[model samples]
Target: MNFKNFGSQKYLLSEKMSGFSSLAHCFTTREGGFSTGKIQGLNLGFRVGDTPEDVTKNYRQVCDDMGFSFDNMVLSRQEHTDNIRIVTEEDKGKGLTKESDIFETDGLITNLKNVPLGIFYADCVPVLLYDREKQVIGAIHSGWRGTVMGISAKAVEIFKEKFGSEVKDIVCAIGPCIGPCCFEVQEDVAQHFDSEYVLKKENGRFNIDLWKANVDILASAGVPRENIDIAEECTKCKNQIYYSYRAHGKEHTGRMCAFIELKD
Candidate 1:
């Protein structure tokens, strides 16, 4: 991942995805927006108790920085399920300029041009998928629950089923999230993953590596290892740059937006 500065706004771009000329993707940081106080900086989440007006301005700021119109963005209403929605041009501006028609969708896929798929995150993993051959793109919000449900693999299935996208033609980028170094979980959470991905720490706690788990899931779904890029950024460790729900709590933390679009 590489840092990109557009005036006061800062975002991360995947080096692998940057080679594609027909795509626009970014993982935003907590910088350059109209939000204030606890939700200061770029708070892109509408349901996180931030003022709707502030969020609207934040969207405009990020859109301006990314050179895309806020009106063409479709935001996900994440429910941590493996549910995937295939968006179209008609779904543009949902959950942004208007109320979202889609709900309980943790992942979104689209072959539509110029309609950006947006997913909010603080600590959860952000996975972006693009099929060069099919001109399809996807954005996923995978928390531990979503990862356990194999939402990343589900997106790959959608790409294949809906657009005839071959797994070999797809490129994936896993963005920043709560890393295994800081994501300690109880037995219930740890039970779903394999022992190889879980680190048994002291006091019956386990550190679950969502990054590697998702990578394995994608690989199982047929995406090549050489085509995947893991940002390896821990939200808890870098709480100052990215929001960390564990570090700052829900009341004090704001959400970042991981967005991707298939250019016209």
Candidate 2:
């Protein structure tokens, strides 16, 4: 994944899927928006204690850069579960306009044109799915629990079941997260993973590679390995470029968005 700064908006694109002439998608960074202080730039998570007005303005700035409408954007509440919602026109602006309408899903999928779908993340992996065959797109938030539970794979499964999409035709991107070098976990993480990739540091902490976990989910969902791209940048390791909740540790932190829509 390469971080791209297009003036007021910074985003990440999958290198493997960069040249594919299909779905429009991006994994945003905390570099280009109107919020200040803890929620400094491009903070799209509306209910993270940031002012609603600031979040709205931030969306406006990001949408302006992405060429989408702010009021029409759709978002997920993200419960760290594998639940994925299929959004439609009726769901537009639910999360932003009606702050009370809490969305309880971790992923959103839609084929509707002009309906921008977004998910938020600080240290968690953001996964974007695009089906060139069905012209549908999906965005998912994969925290450690979500990754181990195969939430990314579930999102693709939904796309396949709902849109008749084949896994081979889907291109997936795993964006920047707390990389293995910095994502030290407890024994609970070891209990969750079924792989040999888990490493135990001399300090009695375990490290799990979420990027590999997500890519494995994609592969299990039938997405070809060649079609998947993982951002090599680690959020915790590169705190200056992106926010890291783990590094900040209760310090107010901003969040980035993973967004996509069917281009009209």
Candidate 3:
């Protein structure tokens, strides 16, 4: 991932997807917007106790900074489920500008140009995908539940079955989340992940490496290891730069997103 600062909106771009001239993708930070309080500065989620007006302005700031039409970006209601939604031009402005009919879906895939598909996060893993050959884009919100459900692999499956995309042509971008350093969990949570992805601390707590787990999932699903890029930044460890649900809980932290659009 390459760090970039455009005015006040600082973000990271996926190196694997950077060479594609038809699209724009970003893993945004918590700086640069009108939001305030617990969900302060560049907050993108309206449901996270942030005012709708401020959230709308924050969205505008990013859309403007990234040269995206605010109405063409589709933001969905994520419930940490493995549900994947196929987005079309009709779904434009659904969650952000218009009233959202989409609910409980944690994944989004689209082929339309100028339509930015986005997934929000604040520690939970955000996996954005692009198939340069097929011009397909996807965004996934893979929290522990979605990770356990294998959402990333499921997305790759959908890319093949629905879009006829070759796995080798697909590039996966794993954004910043809660790294294993501070993703300590109890025995019940640790038991769900594989032994390899979980680390048993001397204190009896377990740390889960979500990045590796998701990368392995994409790899196993047929995407080449070279096509996957991971942002090693941990939202929990670097809460000052990004939002961290683990660092502040649902009631306290703001939200960031992995957003991508197929340009015309």
Candidate 4:
């Protein structure tokens, strides 16, 4: 992943996906926007107690910086489910200019040109997938629950079943989130994942490696290991740059946006 600053706005772009000229994608940071107070600066989530006007301005700022149309974006409701929404032209502007018709959807895939798929995240992992050959793109929000449910792998299946996308041809970029060093979980949460992905610390706490878990899940689902790029930056650790729900607490931290759109 590469950090880019456009004017005052900053975001992360996948180096793997950057080579594709027909696609535009970005993982937004908590920098550069019209928001203020606890949800200050680039808080893209409307439901996060940010002013609606400020949230809309944030979207516009990101769209202008990333060269994507805010009017052509489809935002995810993101209820931590493995549900994948196959986006089309009809879904454009939903959750932005209009009320979102999509619900309980944590993953979004689309082949439609110029229509951006947007997903919100703070500490939760943001997974971006693109099939260069099929001209299809997907953005997924995988919280621990969604990760255990294999939402990234489910996105691979949707690509194949819906767009005839081959796993080998798909490149995935796992964006910044809470890493193993900080994501200490309870026994109940740790039990859902395999032992290999969880580490028991000296303090009687278990740390879950969500990054490795999601990568393994995607690989097991048939995406080539070489084709995946993990950002490796821990959101909790780098709370100043990215939003970290764990570090800043739910009430204070703002939500970031992960976006992908196929070029027209």
Candidate 5:
């Protein structure tokens, strides 16, 4: 992930998809915001204990840096499930008002211009989808459970099933998250994934590779391997630039958002 420094706010972008003009997307970091202490900067998760005013300020800062209206964002209340919502103009500002109580999905997609879709994640994987030929975009929150359920692949499937988008025409960016280096797992969880990529040990513990598993899932669903850009940054190991619920124990931590929208 390439850190984009735009004076007041800093965010991350994929180098591979930098040339896609119609796609406006970003993976926000824990920098350049008004909050203090645990929720230091750019925390988008309202349920993370940050004051509503501070959360609003953080949202505005990120949107201002990206040149998108904060009011146009459709935020999803991620449940770590495979539920993916198809967002429209009517869903705008769902997270900022009464509609905020209505979002129950872990993923969001839209073909509408100026309507940004956002998914919040701390240590969970953030996936961005863009269908160049169909002008469709999707944002997904895939944690270990979601990955086990193949939510990344399911998001692509939902896009194609609903919008008639070709999986080959979609470019995916797997944003920064808890990398395998720090994402140690138990044997029970390891049993849920394919052993081809997961490494088992004599101690009965496992070093599960969630990234490869999701990539494989996407490929199986027809997304080319070369079209996926995986961010090398690991959230658990790089807590200075990210908030890790696992690394931080039960401490109140902020969230990073993966946002995408079709440019008008």
Candidate 6:
């Protein structure tokens, strides 16, 4: 991950995706925004008790820093399902300047230039996809439910079906989220994952590796392993730099955004 800052606001760009000049992407950190009090610093989530005005200001700062207009950015509602929406020129400003018509979508994809796809997360894995050859991009919010449902892998298929993109031409970046180190689950939740990715502890609890689980899903879908980049930062472990729903509780925690746009 490439750490960058514009004034007090800090963000990250994936090492693999940053090499391309055809796209602009950012994974925002919880720093430098108009938000204050309980949910301080770059709180992009409008539903998390933050004012729409403050959230818009936060989005504007990030859009300006990335050299794209916030008006052209499109965001998902993210209901923890595997639903991925293929955005177009008409979808621009859907969840921002305009009232959102999108419903229960966990992912957003687009081939349109200057139309940035955005997804918000606290600890849920945020996956950004780019088809360098086809000029297509995707942003997915893969929480444990979405992961088990194979949203990341489904995204690879979306690239092929929607934009004539080859699996080999698509690259993915899995951003920071709650890691196995702190993500303890019970038998009900642990039963959903493959045993190869689960660690059963002596206390009868389990630790599931969401990062590796997502990697396997993408690779299984034929996205080249070498084309994937994992941030490997655990939001729970590094709560100072990012928000963690488990650490701060959902009501008090803010969300970080994974946003991408095909350069116009």
Off by over 4 Å in 6: none
In model 1, the runs with Cα more than 4 Å from the true position are none
Candidate 4 wrongly placed segments (more than 4 Å) = none
Q: How accurate is candidate 1 locally (lDDT)?
A: 0.90
Candidate 1 lDDT over 1-264, as tens digits, reads 899998888899999899777989999999788889887888998888899999888888888777665787898788888899999778888888877888999998999888888988999999999998999999999999999989999999989988999999999999999998999999999999999999998788999999899899999999999999999999999998888999999898899988998887
Q: Hey, what RMSD does candidate 4 come out at?
A: 0.9
Q: Candidate 3 on 1-264: residue-level lDDT in tens?
A: 888998887898988889778989899999888998877788888878889999889888899888776987888888889999999878998988788888999999998999898899999999999999999999999999999999999999999999999999999999999998989999999999999999999999999999899999899999999999999999989998999988878787888988999999
lDDT of 2 by residue, 185-259 (tens): 889777798656588889998988887888888998899999898887798888777878987655467778888
**Residue 219: error of model 1 in Å?**
1.1
lDDT of 6 by residue, 1-264 (tens): 878899999888888999788889989889788898888999989899999889989988888888876787787788999999999778989888878889899999999988888999999999999999999999999999999999998988989987899999989999989998988999999999999879999999999999999999999999999999999989999988898998899777998999998886
Extract clashing residue pairs from model 4.
Answer: none
In order, the Cα lDDT scores of the candidates are 0.90, 0.81, 0.90, 0.91, 0.83, 0.90
**TM-score of each candidate structure, all chains considered together:** 0.98, 0.94, 0.98, 0.98, 0.95, 0.98
Candidate 4 global lDDT: 0.91
| Segments of candidate 5 deviating more than 4 angstroms | none
